[model samples]
Target: MQSIPYSVTLRPKIFVFTVMGTYAALAPIAVSSVFQHLLAVPMSVLLTMVSVCIFAVAWIMQREETSFKALNRIGISMILAIALPAFLSIAASIYALTVVQSVEYVAYFQHSLLNRLINIGMFATLSLLILFFIQKDVRKVTYSLTQGYFVGLSVLVAGGVWQFLHFTIGYPMPGFETRAFVHSVSEDVLINFRLTSFTDEPSFLVPFLIDGLIIGGMLLSKKAYSLYAIPAVLVLLLSFSVSGYVNLAVIVFSATILLFARGIIPKKVGLYAIISILILGMITVLIFPQLITALFMPIIGRLDSLFDVMHHSRLYMLVFPFVWLFDYSSINALFGFGPGSYDFLARTKYLSHQGAVSGTSNNAFIDLLFEHGVFGGLVFICVFIGVFVYLWRKRKGHLYNSIALLLWIHLGLTNMYRSDFASPRFWIIVLIVIGLTELAKRNITLSDRRASSSYKKKVTT
Candidate 1:
């Protein structure tokens, strides 16, 4: 085996930790009163700055020469998966700007255009950096990534517990009073409080927990220490976010099926998994009985309301946006009315008396259609499907691949209730899976070459 250069090895660890730190800790900390008052900058801008710095560091640390041919081979599927949607989105934005003459619409479009461009560019740059690192040293890079994820999850869970304690005791942590505000203002009537931990919102926390669970589960399947999964699963349950619960259930259901089909899960591990779940359930019931009741009531209520014609249930929220988009003019259908147009219309047409519509469409696919039209929406869908199919075909036997598939299913299902595309969590998982899949393919190629060389040596002898 070839020895990796010190710098090459060190850089990837630093890069992975930085990416994990930015999302898991820094992003949330940036929103706290300490940073807000001291730095006089919003959390979003601070996150963007952090991402840019990380990207620059990764670029500067690239020692191995990346072959154009190698890049071409790795990039072809990604281009089909990402570039088409991006191009269509840009085109839609331009078209909307040119045709929509309203001053309000123009201002909104300009603001959204800048934000969307920054987010897309940042993710793209990070993805390239990840791919480069994978090409250089796949094993080291992946190990670093998984370790970072484990550390980040610990931090998030500790922070969440602290936040929950403060909420329960009615004593605010000095200099971090802002963190408690969400719990105070948005506590569900039934659930009492939703634990967001270090995240800006409960919804934000849920996705990270879900990702953590996926990683933890993968590690557990591989006979690695999986104690971290306990807190990860706990925080997810405490979140009490409907979408979060639904996604968790789906992942668990699908994983069970897969593990059974593969017959790879050991009896000991299966017993451990069951005990963990039982222990967690017992703790919840004994310590916080109301929590279970609170969690289920909303889901039950929502299901009952699904058939209620007078109520706007989650099903309606999922279906109405598409209906509205298709009803628009042909020009608007081809290219969306522009970014932020849905919120604009919601405010002006549907809820004129409710002031500004502060929420997104809550469905990423519908948001894509409303903001970038049919072309962009379709391309975006293809991007997800193409990447998933590619990974599934190439890395089928790897535990990480199963986890990635579960993550994809969770994201696809949960995105119906929330637009998570704008979140770093969504892109981070996608990029990591892509990098891992590429690494798996490269490993297979290396094995084949070694086998061929061995055969030739035997023949010559």
Candidate 2:
């Protein structure tokens, strides 16, 4: 057997464990209704500290030095893309302190400002560390992440099954007692329990499962263990989240196309697989008619609502906040209200008469506009466009880049319904995609240089 180097083994393990540990830390564990801080808060703090330490080690171990000109360009881009938005966030908070009169609002704004600063700082620090260290062995890092995700998916499926059984049997497992009875939109209509398993909510659980499906598909296409994706798909179906279903459809379609195009699966087998899936799906629906309804009725209902603007309050949620922001004074219009101020506005102004719904803007761009103002929103838009441009130019033959593009597209559509930035898992996936894309760019540049050098040497000879 071939032996692996200690550094090789150790580095990938560190990367994998750091990624897994961050996910674990961010996993929501509901304790008492009011004091649910045991795992989520403390683990998050520990993960942040560990991440900082890892960044330090990665910086010290960095070997390759990018050119000064390249570094300068990257530095300026990073400053504008990351630093500017962070500065705007802080500035908005300070401006809020000067203008806002309520103590409660001021305290909320300060807390939100602190949160944004921490989020942006962590994102920038970790991104830089990954760019510096993990870029060299991105393949290894992605493999490690795949392995970790497989384990996580397995656990989630087992727990989801157990939770479903508990729901059906009216008995809770010891030590894994039912945390909450989460219900989907379909459940609200038909009165059925949705599976959350160990996660805090179905909404949270679905995104992780969707990510698992995407990564698992990528791995499977590379001839890694693909069967693990079955359970992930199962759990996602059980979650019955409309967004989850949509994401699953997108992933399956994209993966199928990519795999067929790459000749990973023969045409005959691909056709057979599709037929088998359709037949099995029909059989499953026949066997569990109620289950099918529970899984898809909500999605259909949501789709139906898109045509009826008056009935779908989501449309209002998207437009009213921007209107309200525009109505503010020029300073507020330019810098906007501080973070969490929109939620306050939503509660006091919008939802007070609407009913018991929480005061969320529901749309990420709208929320960004409300919290960070026009300047911050513009900066964010510019950063997004930059990333998309890079991906578009470089994603031709790269599977991961294509996957990242698909994921970003999904995020864009879904963020119209809910802000993905609020989820830690969302940021983790984004960072991984960014790391992979950057590595691809670096590899391509190196290849081009080698090719040019070889051509010149041959001509001289």
Q: Which stretches of candidate 2 lie over 4 Å from their true place?
A: 1-36, 39-42, 61-82, 96-104, 169-191, 220-226, 256-316, 352-362, 438-461
Candidate 1 C-alpha error for residue 302, in Å = 5.2
> Model 2: clashing residue pairs?
none
Tens digit of per-residue lDDT, candidate 1, span 1-461: 34567766676667555575445444334333445456555565566557657756766765457764565233344434444555565666566556656676676666756666566666566556656666665555555555555566667777777766777786664334332232312224465556777665566567666766776654444334356666667667767666788777887877776665456667678878889999998988899877665555544445554455334433444555666665536667776766455655554434223343344757778777777778777777876677567555643465445555776777777677654465555555555565455544554221224224454233212
Among all candidates shown, the one with the greatest TM-score? 1
Per-candidate total of colliding backbone pairs? 0, 0
Task: State, as a TM-score between 0 and 1, how close model 2 is to the true structure.
Answer: 0.72
Q: Which 10 successive residues of model 1 have the least lDDT summed?
A: 178-187
Model 1: how far residue 192 lies from native, Å? 2.7
lDDT of 2 by residue, 1-461 (tens): 34566667577457645664444334333111222345566454445556667666655655557543443233235435545654665666676666666675566665655665565566566555554444455554444444554466556666777777776786676443333443224334453556766765566566666666665554454334355666566667767666667766876686676567656678899999899999999999899998667546655545755545445566666666767776546676776676555655644454323563345666667777777778877776677667667665655555556667766665665566545344444455555565456545554321224225454233212
Q: How do all models score by TM-score? A: 0.73, 0.72
